[model samples]
Target: MQATDNVTLDNCADEPIHIPGSIQPHGALLAFDIDGALQAWSDNAPQLLDLTLALGAPLASLPLPAEVHAIAAECRDLIEDGEAPAIALEVAIGTHQFDCIVHAYAARIIIEFELREVPSDAVAAFALKAHAAIDRFKRQKSIDSLLQLATEQVRAITGFDRVMAYRFHQDDSGDVTAESLRDELEPYLGRRYPASDIPAQARRLYIINTLRLIADINYRPSPLVGRAGAAPLDLSHSVLRSVSPVHIEYLQNMGVGASMSVSIVVNGRLWGLLACHHMTALQVPYSIRMAADVMAQVIASIVQSIEARERALMAEQSAAVRTRVMETLLHHDEPARALLQHAPALCLSLQAEALVVAQYGKLMVHGDIDLALAERMVASLPQSGDEIIERSALGDWPEELRDALAPWAGMLALRFDPSTSGWLLALRREQINTIRWAGRPDKIVRVGPLGPRLTPRGSFDEWRETVRGRAVPWDATARLAAGQLLGEMHRASVARHVETDRARSQLLAMLGHDLRGPLHSINMAATVLQHGGAAGTMSTRIQASSGRMERLISQVLDMSRLNGGLSLGLEKNLVDLVPALQDLLDESRIASPGLRIVADLPPALPLMMDSDRMMQVVSNLVSNARHHGAQGEAIEVTLAERGDTVVLEVRNVAPPIGAEMVANLYSPLKHTSVGNVHNRGGLGLGLYIAQQIVHQHGGEIAYRYEEPQVVFAVSLPRN
Candidate 1:
C-alpha cells in the first residue's frame, strides 16, 4: 500500500478524521497522506517513522490492519502496561502503515498513515524512533540548540544534498547563513540572493503559506480546482501533487531537479526560509516533508535570537565607548588635540581605519591617513557644515584620490558640531562578497580599474575579503566605533563649556568687589565739595575734577551690572519737581559759572519717581548741556506734565546732534559729542546710566535736535 492511496480511505468508526481549516485549534491533531511508491517497502517505512519521531507522537498505540494485528496487539499491551508508544502502527483495517500521536492530555490520538507497501520491521522501528525524537524536541530549550538539532534531524530524514538556513533581508533579499551538507558538498556560507529571484508577488504568497515541495523539476503541474491563470505552486493541501510546470522548468534551469522550502516565522512574520535541495530527480513523501517544515520553524527562532543578541551587545558597547571618550577629552587641559589623538585609537578599538573631524571648510583633525596626502585631501574637499557620506567618487575629492579608493566602499559621516565642525567622517570598507548591485552602477560600484568597482562581482569580493588590507575603504565596525567616540567628544565639550562659564562668572565677581569702594569715595568727595565749599577756588576745582572721576566710576559700575544681568531697583516717591530742578540748576551753576542757565519750572508739579536717581539723571543732563552746549550759551531746564507722566527737558544751544551721534546717543562707549567735551571727559556712562535708571522707573528718555538746539528729556511716571 502506497502513502498516496491512503488519502481516499473512508473508514470512520467513532468520528470522521477532522480535516482542520486554515486556523487549527490548540492541541489539534494534524493528518497528512504520504505519496510515491518505494523501491523497497522496508526502506520507505523508516522515513515515516522519522516523521512520527520529529512530531513527538508515539506510534505503537495506533489502530492497525489485520496483517499487522499481532504486532499491534503486542504494542497495545506494552502501552496498557505503561510502556511508551512505538513507531509501527495500523490504520484503516490493515491496508495502511500509520503513525499515531496522543494529545498532551492523552485523551485521543491523531493517526497519520500512508498506503504504501512497507516492511513490518521497518514500520516498527519508525514508531520507536518517532517517539524518541518527539520526546527530545519537547524537552529542547534555547532557540539555537532547537534549530541545530531540528535541522540535523530533518536532513537525516529527508536525505537532501544540502539543507540551508535562509534569512531574509529588510528588502526581501535572502542570504544563506547556515547549511548542512554531505562531506563532499561545497559550503555556501554567507551567499546572498537578490529579491528579484523570487519576485515580490511570490514572496507575498510565501508569507501566507508554510510548506512548498517540488518533487521533480521535470514533472507537469496539476492545477487546483477553480485556481485560474497559473497552477498553484504551493502543495500543503494537495498531498503528492505535482509542482507547477513553470517552477519546475525554473528549477531545472538552476540545475536542481527537486527542492523543498519551509517558512520560518518569528512573531507571526516570515523571517526566513529553510530550503532543501537535491541535484537529482527525487520524490519526498508528504509526511517527511511536513516534519522537516516543523524542524525549520525551530531553527528560525534561534536565528532571530542570535541576531537580536548581537545588535543589543553592539549598542551597549557603543554607549560605553562614547562615555569614555567624552570623559577623557573634556577633562583634558587641551581638549582639541587630545580628542584628535584619541580618535584614531577609538576607531582602531572599534575596528575602524580613519577618523575625520570637519567643520565648514576646516578639517579640525584627521587620523589614519598618509601625512603627505592628508593636506591635499583636506583642501580638495568642499567646506560644508553638513553630515554626509563620501563614497569613492560621491564626495568633493580629487579625482586621483577618488580613483585610489575602492568601489562599494565609503565613509559614514555624522554631524558632531551643530554650527561649525558639523561633520565627523568615519571611513569603512564593506567586505567584497557582501556588495550588491541594484542596476544603479553609478550609485554603487562593485569593481573598476580606478580602484575596486562596486559592480556585483566587486561588491561580492569586498564582502568575502575579510583581511584588513583587502577591505578597500576601511572596516564598518571601526566606523561605528568612531561614531561612539564622537558622542563622547560632544559630551566633553559640553562639560568644558560649563566649567569655563563658571570661571568667567567668578572673575567678574572679584573685579566688581575690588572697584566698588574707590568709586563710592570719589562720588562722596564730589558731593562734599559742592555742599561745603571749603577752599573757594581750590574746592571748586577739586569738586569739578572729582565729579568727572565719579562719572567714570559710575559708568564702569553700570556697565558691569548691565553685562552681569543685574536688575535695577526703583523706589518711587511723590516729590516737588520744581525743587529737584532748582537743586540741580544750583549745582550746575556752581560747577560751570562760565555757562548761562535758565530754568522754566511750574510752581506745583509733583512727580512720582525715585528722587535720588532722578536728581542724578537731572544733574547728568544739565552738566552735559553746560559742557557740550555752545560755551557760555544759556542751558534751559523745563519741567512739565502731559498725560500720566511728568517730563523734564534740558535744552542746549550746542552744535546740532549728528545723525550718527543721535543713533548711538545712549551708548556707553560710543558717545561721540559727550566724550569730546573736555569738562565731561569719561566713558560717557552718565547718559546711558540715566536712561537705564529712567527706564527702571517705567519712564522713557529721548533726545531731539532742532539745528541750533539739542534737547534731552526724561519722562517719569506720575504719582
Candidate 2:
C-alpha cells in the first residue's frame, strides 16, 4: 500500500514515475535470467498464466510455446540494433490465447501477457484499415488537416471517447492543435497543458516506448516479486509498467477511466502525442494498438518531408528581394540607399515591424521604429560575432537601452561580422497576447494533512491576462531566412569591394594617359618661350597649356577626396545670386567658344547659401553643358524663389538619355569621349560632384529628359 500523506508539493518533482514498483492487474509480467528460468513474476501471474512451479522454475515446466523463446531472442537483439527492445506477438498456450510482449533491459528479460486474441478475419481487416489511414494522410494538403485526420483515424480504429493531436512548444508545454471526440465528450481542442504534467524522466521513457496504453484506470496495481535474494525487476521496457499514482488521480479527476498515447516523432525527436481517452474502462486489443503505432510513424515521416518543401518555397521568395538589393549595390556606390529600395521585402517577410541595417558604421532604418532606440540597440550589440541575438522582451534589456526601446519589445539582430560593427536588427512591437490554459496552473496545489500536496486543479476556468513588453517569438522559419540573408549579404559585400577595386584601377589607368598630353605640351611650349623664340605666341601657348594642366590636377584631387568619403565643408550667408551668375557665365563663355550660355534670374533674388560651394556646383554643370550638351543649343540657368525655398534649374536641349542608362550616368569615372580635343575622355565627375554639393546643402538635384531637352533641377531651402 502507498501513503498519500507522504506526497508534498515540494517533493512531487522527485516522484519516481519511471519505476512505479508494480504493474497493472489487466496484464501479467515476468522477469527471467539468460538461462530462460523465471526469476521474478507479478503477483497475478500465477493465476493469469496458471503456472505449476515455484520461483526460478524453467519455463519448460509450464505450457509455454517454442515460438515464444525464439521471438524473445529476436526482441532482445533490438537493443543492440539501436531499436526499442519490445515486440508484440500473439501466442496460444494450453487452450488459452494471449497477446505477448517481450522486452530486454540490462541483465533481465521482461515479458508481458495480456488476455487477447485476433480472429483470422480480423487480421486481414486490421491491415486494410491501417493502409486506408495512410492514404488519408497522403491526401492532406496542410499539417493542420493532416493531424486532424490522424486523430480522427485513431479514434475510428480504437473506439476511444476522445482523441487529440497535441503539439509541443519550445517551452516543453503542449497545446491541443487538433482533436476528434464522441458526441457525449467535451472538447479539449486548443487547450494548453503545463510541462510539469510530464516530468523529464517520464519523457525519456516515452522515447523508448513510443506508445503507451492504460486498459483499466481503476485496476489494482500488481507487484512484481523476485526470488528471496534476487534484485527487484527493472520494468523500464515492460509494457505493463504501472503508471504514476498522481496521474491516475488526474485522469480520475477528469472523469477518464482509461487512456492511450502514441508518440509522434519527427527527425528523431519527439514532436507531439496522439492522445486518446475514454470515459469508461476500455480494453484495447494488442492488434489495435499496433495499427495506431504504425499510423504515428507514417505521420512522422510525412511531416518532415512537408516541412522541408515549405522552407524551400519561402527561401526562394526571400531571395528575390535580396537579389535585387545586391544588383543595385553592384552598379551603384551606396549600400544604405540600395537596401532601402527593398524595405518592404525585408520587413514583411521577416514578420518585423521595422529593420535597422548597419554596414561599415553607416545605418539605414526602415519601417516603424524610434530612430534613437534602434541606434542604441544596434550600438549595444557586440561587434565580434555573427551570432543572431534575440530579445523577446525589451524589459530584459540593459538599463541604458530599455527606455529607448520603449513601445517595441522584441528584436532579432544579425551581425555581418564579429570583428566589425555592422548589423541587421529586426524589431517587433508588444502584442496583447491571449493564451488558453487547461486550468490556473499556478493554483494546482492543495493543502494536505502533512503539507501542501500537488494535485490536478478542480476547475478549468477561463483565464485572461494582459501581456506587455514582449513581441511575438522569432520562429524557426524566420531565423532560417535570416541565416540565408546573412550568407547572401556577406557574398554581396565581398563582390562590392571587388567592383570598387576594379573601378579605382580603371580610373588610375585613365588619369595616367590623360595627364601625359598636358605635360608634353607644357614642356615644348616652355622650351620655345625660354629660348626667346617668338615670345608673345610661345608665352600664350605656355599659359594655356599650364591652365589646362591645373584644371586636370584639381579634378583628380576632388574625385579622390569624394571617393574617400571626405566632408565638403560649407559656409552659408544670404547673398545676391545675380552677380555670382554673371561671373560664372563669363568663365563658361571663355572656356567653351562653341556653345551658347544665358542666365535668367530675378534682379533681387537673394538666399542663404555657401557662395564658394554653389559656385563650384554651377561651374561643374556649366562645364558639363559645354562638353556634353548639343553644339548649337543654349544652356539655360534659371533661379526662382518661392516663399522660403528656391529652385535652380539647368536645362539644355539635347538627345534624351535612355531609361536603362540614367542610373549609371551618375557613376563617377563614367563618360563618353567628345568628338574634338578640348574635353576628350573627361572623367565623369562633373555631374557627380555637383550632386554631392547640392545634397550637402540640404537640397536635391534630379535629371529628366523632356522632348528635346534634359533638365537638372536643384531645390534648396532658402532660410
Candidate 3:
C-alpha cells in the first residue's frame, strides 16, 4: 500500500489511482518527462475521463505507459455519448507517481494543503511571468529591434542553437536579416538563398502547414501509422500546428539534422519564416516549440512598424526634393534653352559635367560636346513622350549620325518632347582606356621581349560594362522627383504658349474691329452712289467690291469674338419654322437669280432657340451649299420636328464632295489642290465657326453625302 503522507506510487503503473478530494479539480492534463521538465496537456482531458466513468460502468486504472491510449479511447466513447469530461494528469518524476483528476469543465487546478501544501503562489507566479512576456511584446514599436529582441528571448527560453528572422523577396528568394546564434556556432547572417533551392511546390506546402518540425532529419521512421486520437489540425488558424513531410526531406538534403520553422504572417499574407536550425541531431519537445512560435508573433509586429517608418521617410524626402527643383527652375525668366544651360550647374550643383537642350525635334543648345555627338545620342533615344536612357557602342555610327566626335565612350540621353522634335540632353564620358593603349607595346604585338610592355590597370571596356545594361543611376524616389520637376517645367512652357496665342488673337480682334467701321462706311457710300447716280458699270463694280469687303470684315470680327470666349445670349421664344425658312429662301433667290430655290417648311414646327444665331447657322449652310453646287441647280431648305429637337436642313443638287474633301472640309487650313476636280477657296473656317455658334445655342450641325448632292443639317432644341 502507498504511504498516505509520502503520497508515492512506484511500479503502481497498473494500479487504480485515487484523487484526493481536497484538491480542486480542473479539466487540464499535465505531462512531465523524467529526463526534462513538465509539459501541459490539453484542457479537455479531465472532462473526457469523467464522462467515461459516468456511463454506468466501473472505471479501470490503466498502466502509466498506456495512460494516453486509454484516455483517448475513453474520450472517443464519451464524445460519442455527448458527455465527455475534462481530465488533469500530473506525472511526478521524483515520486514515480501519476496523479489524475476529472472535472466537468475547464478551471484552475488548485492543490490546497493545510500546513505544507503544494506552493499555489509559485504556480500563480509562473502564469504571471508568461503573461508579462506577451505584454512586453505587444508594447514593442520597432520591428527590427523587436525581431532581434524576440529571437534572443526565444533562444533563451528554448535553448535553440540559432534563431533567424528570414524574409521573402519579391522573387521568392529568402534572406536572413537577423539571427541569434550560440557562442560556439559560426553565424549565418546576411545570407540569401535562391528560390529554386526551395522550389515552388515546397513554398505552397509551407504556407498550408504553418509550423513544421524536423525532430531529427536523419532519424529513422518509427513506422507507427496514424498516432491514435490525433485530432485533424487546421493550420490556417493563428494557433495551430501541422508539419509537411516534404520539408523534412528538404532539410535532410541540405545536411541539416534538425529544423523548426514558424510562419510569419502580415495582413493575412504569408510574409516570411522564423526558422531555427541545428546541425547536430537534436529534438525539441512540443512545449518548447510552442514557446518559440509565441515569440514569432511579437517579431511580426515589429517588422511591420519598421517598414511603415521607412516608407514614410522616403516619401517625405522625395516631396522635399521635388519642391526645391521646381522653385529653382521657375526662379528665372528666360527661354527653355537659357534656363537649361544654367540648370545643370544650379539644380545639380555642377555635379554633371555637361548639359544639352533639345527643342522642336532639334538640338538647340549643347555644352562641352560636339554637335554631331549630341545629335547621335538624341537619335538613339526612344520617341515616346516619357523620358528614357540608352547604352550603345560609340564606334558603330549609324548613317544619321556619322560625323560625331570619334565614337562616344559612354553617354546618357534624356528626351524632353518628341512631338515638336524637342530637345535631347546628352552627357558624355570619354573612353580613357583607348588613350592609354595607343603607344603601348601590348597594343602592337602579341610577343614582348622586354618582360611584357606596360599595361593599363583600368580600361574603358571595364567602365562601360559597369554602366551599361543597367537602369539609370537614379533610384525610384529620385526618378519620381525628377518627373515632378519635368511636369512643372512643361506647365510653364504650356502657359507661355497660351499667353502668346491670347495676345495674337487679341491683336487680330482689334484690327478686325477697326476695319469694320471703315468698311461699313464704304458700303453705305457705295449704296448711295449706285442709287443716286446712273447705275453705271463703275458704280455697280464699286458696290460689289464694298459688299465683299464688308463680308470679310464680319467674318474676321465673328472669329475673333469666338476665340475670345464671347458668350451667345439666347432669347427663347416659340417661333414658327416656316416663316424663317421663307425669309431665307427670298434672300437666297435675290442673291443668285439664275439658281432654282425650294422651301419645304413645316407650319406647325416651332423651336426654342437663339433666333439670331439660328439664322446665321442656316445662312452659312445654305450659302456654302449654293457656292459649292453646280450652276442652275435647285437648293432646297427643309424644316421639321423630330423627337425632342427641331431639324432644319439645306440640300443642294451638285457634284458629290470628293472623299478627301469630305473628310477634311471642316478642318482649318485644309487646302485641297486637286485642279478643276477640287475647288478650295475659303480659309475653311466658315463651317468651323458655324458649328461653334450652333453648339453655343444647344444645337448641332452635321453633313451627309448623297449621290450628286450634299446636305448640311442643323438640329435645335424644341419648345
Candidate 4:
C-alpha cells in the first residue's frame, strides 16, 4: 500500500467486485434444478445450442448424446456433496459437436459450453512450454525484469491479447508495473488503478483460488432457478460463477471482451495480480491456467530471494560505514567536527541529502541543507532513546518546524543512547514525481441509464498528476541497517561507562588489599615487645614481617608491568630448581607446623631461568597448595628434566574449584575481598604475577584438576 500513514481509498473499499452474476459470451451457461431439469439459461445459450426455452424440461430428455448424460450425472453427484466441479466432455446434439463444462454450484447446476479445439499433443507441448517459461523467470536479475518476463511468458502460453503485472499498494490501490501485449494494442504499464476495481472479498478469493477467467464479458447471465425455500448461492468458489453486473459493465466500459487473472502470492500474502485481457472472445483450458499459476509462484519466490539478497548487501555495506564512523567518534574528542568531516560519505551511504547530529542539547548540521532549519529540526526531535524510528513528510511536521524545513520533505532520526541522546538524523529533499492514471482517477462513478453506477474508466487516455511533499521512499533494508547501527552505538556507549567505572574501583581495592598484611605484622611484633618477650624473638618477628612486606611490594610492581604489556626484566642465571623449591618448602614447614610437604626431584638438575622469579613462582605455588589443599595430604613438588625442558609439578589435594573463582584468581585487580576474604592473608595477585614472571623467562605455567590432586605445572626452556 502507499507508505503514507493517512490512507484514503474513497469508494474503493465499499465496492463489491465479487458477487457478479454474468458469464462471458464465448461460453453459454444453463442453470438446472436439483432434478436435472433445465430451469434458466443465458440468452445466448438458446441460439448457440439450437434449443428453445423449456423451463421445466429435464435435461436428460433433450435428445443430447450419452456423454452429456454422463457429464450431468457427475455434476449431480458433486452437487449433492456441496462441491463445485468442472467436468470437460464432448457433446453431440443433432449433428452439432461442442465441448461442455458441467459445473455444480449452490442452489443451481451450471453447465458452460465452449467451442473446443483438438491439439495433436496438447499435454507434451504444454509441459515443454511451462519448462521454458520457468527457465526465463529464473534468469531474470531484478524484480522489474522478472515481472516483465512473467507477463510475456503468460501471454505466450494463454494467447491473451494483453497481459500485465499489477502490484497493489498498502491502501489496496494498484498500478500496472509490467505489461506485454499485441503490437496493435496500447500499453497500460505504469497506469494506476483504484482499489475499488478489486475489493476485499475479491482479493481474498484470488488468494484462495489463485486463478479466475472471464472468457467473454459481452455474454448474458444465466439466472439460477430458485427453489421454494432455497437461499441465494454463495458462489465464491465456483469456477464458472457469473460475474456481477457492475463488473460486467466495468469490463465492457474498458472495451475488454475477455479477461483472466492469476494471483501472485508471496510469504503467504497476495502480493499482486497477473492480469490478461483480450479484445474478442477467448477460451483457455484449465491445464493452461494451472501452468500459468506455476509461473506466478516462481515469480513470487524470486521476488522474496531478490529482497533478501538486497538486504544482505545493504547490511554488508552499512557495517563498513558504521565502522568508519565509529572509529572517527572514538578518536576525535569533538562530536560536531567528526560529524561534519564524515557527513559527505555518511550521507551518500544513507542516500540522504542532509545530515544532523544531536548530542546532549547541542545540534550540528551537515551536507546540503539550510543550517538553521536542520538545527531546529534536531533540537525539536527527542534527544534520548532508540524506541521510535520516525519517518514522516515535512508537511505533517509541526507548524513551527514545517516553515523552516522547506528545503527538505522527509526526516529520519535515531537515538543511539538514552542518557546522552546521541541522535543521528538524515534528511531528504522533496522528490517530485509525475504519476499517470488510466483515466480521471478521481471520477470513478458514472451516471448511467438507471442510476449512479460504479465502473472502470471508459477511456484509456493518460491522465497525469504531479506528486509533491514526499521524499524518495526509504526501503526496508535501509531501515533495518539504520536500526542495527543504533544498536551497535548503544553497546559501545555502555561499554565505555563500564570501563571507566572499573578503573576507579580497581585503585581503591589495590591499596586496601596490599597494605593489610604489613600493618597487621607490625602490630603483632609491637604487641610482643610490649609484653616483655625476648628482645631477639621480637627483632626476628619485625625483620620477617618487614621482609614479607618488601616481597609483596615487588609483586605489585610486577603486576603493574604486566598490565602495561611490559616484560619482567628477568635476572637470569643457571639455578637448581630443586634447591630453590626446597628452601621455600622448609620455610613453609616451619611457618605452619601442621603443614604436610613432600618433594621428588633429581639432585643438582640445573636450568637457565630468572633465578629470583623462578623462586617466587615456586613459592607462590607452595603457598597456594598449603592454604587450599586437603589438611592431612602431602603437598608434593616434583622437578625433572623432560627432553630439552625443565618441568616443575606441584600437586595438592583439595575440593573442586568453580570455573568463575579460578578465572577471578587469574584476572587483574579482581577479588571478592582483600586479605582474609580468601581465608588466607595477603593480596590475590600471587598466581597472576607468577604466570607473568614465568612468561618473561620463556617458560609455561598451567593448572588442572587431577582427581585427588590439584596440579600446577611449570615448564622452563633448558638453555
Best by lDDT: 2
Tens digit of per-residue lDDT, candidate 4, span 267-305:
777888999999997877656776898888888899989
- On TM-score, who's better, 3 or 4? 4
State the RMSD for candidate 4.
15.8
Q: Give the TM-score of candidate 2.
A: 0.83
Give residue 565's error in model 4 in angstroms: 34
Worst-scoring 10-residue span by lDDT in model 3:
108-117
lDDT of 2 by residue, 354-394 (tens): 88877655567887776766778877887565478888886
Every model's TM-score: 0.44, 0.83, 0.39, 0.58
Query: Which regions in candidate 4 have their CA more than 4 angstroms from the true location?
Result: 1-12, 15-17, 21-127, 170-173, 227-231, 319-351, 382-386, 444-455, 500-719
Off by over 4 Å in 2: 1-15, 53-55, 66-70, 73-85, 92-97, 117-130, 227-232, 417-420, 443-458, 499-594, 598-618, 636-663, 671-682, 693-719
- lDDT string for model 3 (1-719, tens) is 32233211121221211111111121223322111122223333334233221111122332233554455444434442233343334343223333333221112111100111234344344445545666777777766566666666656554568888777765565666678987887565666554543445445545654565655565433211111342221122111112233344456544567777777776555677877877775544433454565556555665666666765676566456445545543432223444464455323431234556665433544456776666666666666745645333444335454345443443444444344455434344544432111111111112234322222111112111122221223334434444554565566556645654764565455445444544665666677776785457546656655665565556666665654445444576777667776787788788778778778876666666656667777777877777778777888888887888878888988767778766555543233421223222233456766776776666777888787778888887774
The superposed Cα distance between candidate 1 and the true structure at residue 446, in angstroms, equals: 28
What's the lDDT for candidate 4? 0.73
Model 1 lDDT per residue over 1-719, tens place: 22222211111111111111111111112221111111111122333343222222223333334534354344444453233243333344233334332211121111223343445465455445544555566565554455455556666677788787776766566776667887786566567665544544345445655776665666433221211232222322323334332345446645676788888877666677777888886555445655665555545555566656765676677766676667655544334334565675556555556665544343444544654444444445455644344453234344666655543145555655554344555555535443433222222322234343222211222133222223344344445655565566666667765765664565455344434444565556667676874546645555655665566666676766743435456687887778877877887777656767888889888777777888888888877886677866788888887888788899988778778667657755442423253433555567778887886776889998877899988887775
lDDT score, residue 558, model 1?
A: 72
Give lDDT per model, in order.
0.54, 0.76, 0.51, 0.73
For every model shown, the clashing-pair count is: 46, 3, 20, 11
**Model 1: worst 10 consecutive residues (lDDT sum):** 32-41
